[model samples]
Target: SLSDRLQGTFDKLRGKGRLTEDDINSAMREIRMALLEADVNYRVVKTFVSACKEKCMTSEVLDSLTPAQNVVMIVLDQLTKLLGSTESKLVLAQNRTPNVIMLVGLQGSGKTTAAAKLAYLLKGQGHSPLLAACDTHRPAAADQLQTLGNEISVPVFRGDGKDAVAVARDSIQEAVDHLNDIVIVDTAGRLQVDEEMMQEAVDIKSAVKPDQILMVVDAMTGQDIVNVVREFAERVDFDGVIMSKLDGDARGGGALSVREVTGKPIKFVSMGEKPDSLEVFHPDRMAKRILGMGDVYGIIEQAQKVADEKQVEDAERMLLEGFTMDDYLGQLQQIRKMGGLQKMIGMLPGGERMLQQAGNQADESQLTKVESIIRSMTKEERKKPKKINGQRRKRIAAGSGHTVQDVNQVLKQWDQMNKMMGKMRQMTQVSPKGKKKG
Candidate 1:
């Protein structure tokens, strides 16, 4: 919603040929309101707005032919600055046999999941990571960590489920014995910040001397995140933050507040429930996404991860030729590999408007039905959807356990998609003079 609000403000600015002081002020006012409504810390919002206003008021922006674009760039810069300016990478101690990474946060802030996610990430990077279940205070916390570890194929070390400090300290030695290069310690958490919880975290830190301490914060914590982070900074002096549940429907105020409040960077974000969903945080890309410019690089990265060279070539060939149902189904599976349609749309510029134009085809829940319908078709029907007559449609609907209307709807959507691809191909074709073909 903050993204939508900000995009709307910029859209108004973009509509104008030039900007006046009044226009800049009006946009600033809207931005201020959007941030506040999104639950950004009042002081952070005030400071951010002031900085953006100062930058936008300059003649470089006011007198520019593309004043709106200039203002958007200025805002993007400031937002990136507010979100920690640069990427904060996880620092593991060099030459250390086993690097220790400690996770701390309030209860339900996703510390255990974050630990597993981080371990999974490290393991992918060729490090042998071991997870330590040090949250003896929480019921089944060790079991949960063990389950996640098993899913990731990483080892989990648990103590007697009585002394968290001992468990954390022993985890390092366990890593040494097994030749694990990194040990991620999942610390205990309280429902709220308290002296006892803080002291226990401090005690564990003293005992293990972790190479990096990541403070896990729920992205939905809103205004209270500032205070929670402040207390953690005062106590554990965390190295960076692991922002969890960023894929939730929260306004994302806590994520914006944490770095500014604690003078720390957000190292990673837990964007999904899967262990592989922990992503390295990039402030510039995030700022662009927030401003509705989209993260093209991020989309490319996701594509690279999911689609191989042949898959890409196949997709290109399908774009040139007509996309058969088989091609469409393969693309849908690739999208699923890249986090589903909703997520792919979220990474695109003006994605909301794009979804609006695409209608039900963009709905993630409809993907299952569409897949089922396509799968129910015979291979010949899939290769030549044009030959699917009334009887064939009825058969497909019955086979896919859907109404005939549903089958027809899927056919209509596929036709529309093919038409759109045709238009795109025509628009992108080069003429002899190197100009785009009409």
Candidate 2:
């Protein structure tokens, strides 16, 4: 919503050839209101808007041929700076055999999930990571961590009835015994900030002497995050932040406020519920997304991670000879692997507007239905869709547990996709004169 609001303001400015001081001030008013409504800390919003206003009023910006573009760039720069100009990586100790990363935050902040996601991320990076269940106060907290660890195939070290501090200290020993290179301790949190929670976090920190203490703040916490983080910073002196639930329907004020208010860089953000949904935070990429410029590089990085030999080969073939149902299924699977079409679309320029226009079209359930329909088809029918006549459609629909109309919809979509691919194939074809055909 902040992205949409800011983009709308900028679109108005971009439509103008020349902007007076009044226009700049008007846009600033809109931006200030947008930030406030987004739940950004009031002081931070004021400072940010003031800085942008000063920069935009400079002669260099006001007298520029593309004044509106310059103004947008200024805002981007300021936003990036506000978001901690650079990416802060989760640094592990190279000399230490088992680098300990302790997660601290309020209860319901998704600390347990963040622990598993961090372990999953580190394990994927070729490190042996062991999870430590240190949240002794909450019922089933250790069980939740263990369940997540099992899902990620990482080992979990529980202290049973031991205190949080003892569990943390022992988890390091467990890592050493098993030759685990890292240990992530999921520390206990309270329903709200209190001396008890802070004391427990300090005790755990002192016991394990973690290389990094990541404060896991819920992204939807809004301005309340400032006070929570301040208390945590004063007590545990955390190294960085792990923002969870960033993909929620919140205004994202907490995300914007944390770095500026606490002076701690955000090391990672949990975009979705999946274990692999944890992504290293990049301020510039985030700034681009907020401005509706999108994160093209992020999309490419995600694609490269999931793209495989077969996927690439299928793509090449699709361009040359159109795609079959099997190919479509493969592509859909690939999209799912890359966090679904909604995520991919969100990282595209103007994606926010496009999503607003195409409500529910980016829904993942639709993709699932299409997958089921394609799978219900015979192998021959998948390869040669033309073989699916009325009778076959009825059978395929019955098999997939859908009406024949759903099958016909899938076939119609396939036809549309093939027509587009045909156009692409023709365009990519080389002529005898050594030029590509149009």
Candidate 3:
């Protein structure tokens, strides 16, 4: 929606070669309004807009580019920078077995769901995870976890008529006896992070000596989530945060403010109510999403993890030499190693916008279809697209589970990009030194 709004603002100047100061200013004003409307913190919005303005004044806009897109990318980058560029991992205690993870939050913040989700994730990762239902104050809370545990085939530990701290302590021993790798203690949530709740959480932490304390907050709560996070952090000295209900249209300003105020990393985000909807929190991607851009930096970082220097060099060389179907396949492999195309796009500068547009045009399955079609091609055919005739296209499409039109579209895009790159090269060659040139 942000992307569409931005595109609409820049639609009038779509064919412009260079942007005027007025164009940049007008587009930025609109972007600022959109962010504010999204419920971003007022101060955060002001700082973000100011930084974007400074960058737009200095950054180069491509020929035939809408300055709006360029400014959008600037804002996106700034937002990503604000969200730390790394995925925060839980710190395990070196001298302890059955690492204790204590969950604390206000009622309805999804603390119970997050605890169960974390257990499921850890179990999937080959860790023997045990969930401890310590919400003795709420009779149905333990049953809730038990139901989820049964669905996921993980074990839930609870003690009848026991104090929360005692239940937590007993769960630790149960984890040890079972040789569990992690013990997730789902504690009680209160209407607010009041002194009683704070003291209760503190007592549980001290009794169990949890290795990590995570404060779960609902993203839709907006700025109020920050206050909850800060209060819990102060009382329990939480090690990390878990943001829930992130799949909704929550502005996510609370995430920024909570992290900034508490200096705690966000360990996970609950995208939905589904068991598998939990994802490791990626600061860069979150930042891009908040700024209404795709996550380009996240893509690059993931690419760097799986890609070596040689693969990148080869890809760059292929792009310069002229992209072939084989080169396209190679690019796909590189992208796959970095994660999937959609995920990589989410990490890019304008990734969110690109993804929103691309999603409207084609789903993720289409990307797989394109990859499959490329995979089905002969090495020679990929290297030389001129050799791909109608028969070849049909065969490739059939093998890759795609329509012939899909193959044609990929080729058409490649051709358009090749022509654009050639024109840019020619222009650069004819341009005057250190001055604007046609």
Candidate 4:
């Protein structure tokens, strides 16, 4: 995992007072290799590393903190920025009765599945959506949409013997008559983006005046996805993109390349085959996941959304005050309110890597044990772990259905961390006053 690898890279310099040029260079080298291994484009990685190195060169390292961690954060921020620092929403014309969304891609790009997923997503938000099956060429393509529509409880419009343009026209009229707010038109895809497919897609767009033309590409297709997106965008001038099969073990360079090539925002990501598996595209979260950094910023944003101002302020205060066991447990509850631990981690910088590592090391049983142990502690014991001695540890372990050794391990790790922070404080007080590090 990226976090474990990064943590290992900086483990030797954990208590160091400052970062030298050599430290930055060594860390950057490792990061560069990691990015390449993750299948990031070579040019993109080069540019990213150069920018990160420049920032690291000018960055001051905090006393008693690993310069490598600081560098990691810098790289994480840059990665987020490179991926487009915000979520991409589907564009809809304000005064338009029905928002026409045309989906285009090569054959087997999951266009039909994506269209149904989009409809399901829009319906969840209280918008009545209609699915248009413009793919009359492929065998059972319209039937596939009809099946998905039945599952999602949305209407699917299709016309036998009608061309793609005529199908789109009829679907838009049906959407308006039914008072549907959005129309998702799934077009026929070819093995390649040839002149015929291009012209047909353009004709449909011309007929319907689609508010958004989204190019769908399979993430597992690698760099070829970029070429397909470019060809489609050139022909029909798409408004956004949709990358499917992201749940698979794809390196995801295709996403970066497609975005770079088409200059269009990715509106949605299909993680699975299910109709509800579509997510509004968030570039920052994706980038952080790729870099092996947990999406800390994303967590904060979600926490702010669901939590009241006072609760959010309190959590922030606790985090700034050096989190304790009680605070940790409280945070767990708060995080649960927003989502589960795995989900929260997925939103963090290098989150995917951290979750992978954490999952490998500690199974669900371990998490259950940890939660139970925390629950058994008295309020005072949680706030002040120094109060937990041999007898208390034995009592807590027994109550939580764990062994004494398990309880001891948690305490030992916490104590070590406290000692390290203490050393960091001391180092800060003795170090030079003018420079503050990342």
Candidate 5:
């Protein structure tokens, strides 16, 4: 949406090899409005616009042959800088064997969920993490943490009922006893301005002396998040932020506004409720996304993490030999693991626009329907789909609860996919280090 908005604003400047103050003024006005509409803090937008305007005024930008491109470049560069130039890692201490991390946030901000997600992320990074339930204020908070811990196969350190401070202190020893190299403490969520809540967080910090105190804030809170972060920084003093409910936020620029406004980097974003949906926040990738360039690197990285090596190799082998309905079903499962179709599209350039073009056809639910259709077929039918005549096609349509045309559509799609995979397999076999082998 930001890209579309900017496109109209920059249309006038497109042919101009050199930009005057009026051109810069028109562009900055649109940019400023776009950022504000995206829920970025007002002061942040003002500063960002001013910085971009200053760069446009430079002689080099004025003389550049591709002045319009240069203007876009300036915006991207400023956005990346505003978001924090480099990826911010959750700071861990080398001297400490079990790095303790305390998660703090307001009520319903997803602190408990973020803890498990972070553990899942850290476990993937080769660290054995233990979840510590230190949120005694809420009912059954310990049980909730234990459930999440079970889901991730991470150990939980739950102290005897209603002693959050004791839990915080005891979890350290539990980490040592279990040989968990990291401890993620889920603290009770509270309002930033609440004195009682602030004191409790302070007490726990004093007791555990955590390596990192990350505030898990709801990204959709917009400018309210800025005030909350400022309040927490003044009192509890968090090291970084973990933006939760990120995927649901339509106007996410406010979350990005925190880094510039509060001098704290956003270390992670909880994109979805799934344990594996947490991603390390990369500013450049986010900037690219806002500019409609897509986050191809992040998408590929996610694919690498979830892609089963053996399954993929087997699929490739099958593609070279012959593809079956079973192979097609397996590929569908793999795409689900890679965060479904919409996510895949979001990671590619012009993906949102493409989704708009696709209407309802590219909906993630289609994967389910396709999988159902494949499953409705018998094993013999799955292996040799060509053998299925009119009668069997009707039976599969009945079984999958779809129209006969749907079954035909699925068959057609599989046929096309099989051909494409065959081509890919041939290319890979013939190519030698990206060159065709003679």
Candidate 6:
């Protein structure tokens, strides 16, 4: 969406060898509009566009990028810096037995959900995380967290009382008792920021003396989120911010403004509702995505998280030899581990454009259908798909609850990938000394 609009602006200046005043003016106007339309805060959009314009005007366009691409690069650079240049990790003290992190935000900002997500992430990193339900005000806040904790297989700590402060204080002992290296305290939230809410947050902070107190802000709120962040920062003095519901189709302009205006790095972003949907916020990757330059590195990181080294080596070997239907299923599984097709597409540069071309086939359900079709096949047919004659194809389609055309589609995709992988393997061949053998 942002990519298409910006590309339209850049297309008119295609013939220009260098960025002239007129070209820069036209480009900046388009960029300004694009950012604003993307729901970026007005102040942030103004500052970002101004910086990109100034840089493009003063500096020579790099020979590597086209005049249009050069200006895009300038914008990308500024946007990256506008969002934080690097990842802000949730640091824990090595000396401490249990690292406490308190999550605070207004109601519906996803504070409770974010807590479980954080625990899921920490648990993945080999830390024993205990979820502390310090949210006594909400009717089912504790239950909601407990459900999430159950889903993630993490322990929940809830003291038998209405006092959130005491519950948080006692969670430390709970953490130590459970041998949890990390304790995530999910605090109560109100419809809006009020004195009572602030006081409760302050009391939790005072009682727990958390290692990090993160303010959770809803990214869809745009500029209004800044006010919430400011209030929480002033009242409770949060250590960092965790913007939630980023997966939703919000302009995400609020995210662009949060760090610059507040002077706090966004440590994490809640991408989806699942416990595993939380992702460590990487500014450069996000900026690249905004510019339609896919995040290859981020995709690789996610892939690595789900795939073992042995599996990677085996996949490469299989690709070089001849990937089978079973191998095809394995590849799909790996992609699924990396957050499915739609998410993967977002990380690729020009991915959204490609998505437009692919049409409805890019949906995650397609992958599921493909997996079902593969599973319906016999082991012999999977190893040698050519054995799957018309009757077998029909059987697979019927078993997978799809038409024969869908099964045919799956087979066609596998064939394409097999051929492509063969080509890649051939092109990558080298001599013993790592030089081209031919």
Q: List the residue pairs that clash in candidate 5.
A: none
lDDT of 2 by residue, 1-438 (tens): 888899889889988978899999999999999999989999999999999999999888888898988888899999999999999898988899899999999999989999999999998989999999999887788889888999999999997646888888888888999999999999889888999889988888888899999999998887788999999999889999998997876635788888998899999999888998999998988887777666645754665677865554455566467789988787678788876688776665555555566574967788889999999999999999977999999999999999999999889867756765564343232222332111
Question: Model 5: what TM-score?
Answer: 0.76
Candidate number of the best TM-score: 1
- Locate the minimum summed-lDDT window of 10 residues in model 3: 429-438
The positional error of residue 195 in candidate 6, measured at the CA in angstroms, is: 1.6
Question: Candidate 4's residue-wise lDDT over 385-408, tens digit each?
Answer: 988999999999999888999999
lDDT of 6 at 351: 51
Could you tell me how far off, in angstroms, the CA of residue 16 lies in candidate 3 after the best superposition? 5.1
Instruction: Give candidate 3's TM-score.
Output: 0.67
Give the Cα lDDT of each candidate.
Answer: 0.84, 0.84, 0.71, 0.73, 0.80, 0.79
- lDDT at residue 415 of model 5 (Cα atoms): 72
Between candidates 2 and 6, the one scoring higher on lDDT is 2
In angstroms, give how far residue 339 of model 4 lies from its true place.
Answer: 5.3
Model 2 spans with C-alpha error above 4 angstroms = 308-339, 364-438
TM-scores for all candidates: the values are: 0.80, 0.79, 0.67, 0.76, 0.76, 0.78
Better of 2 and 5 by TM-score: 2
What's the C-alpha lDDT at position 85 in model 1?
Answer: 80
**Alpha-carbon shift of residue 50 in model 2 (angstroms):** 1.1
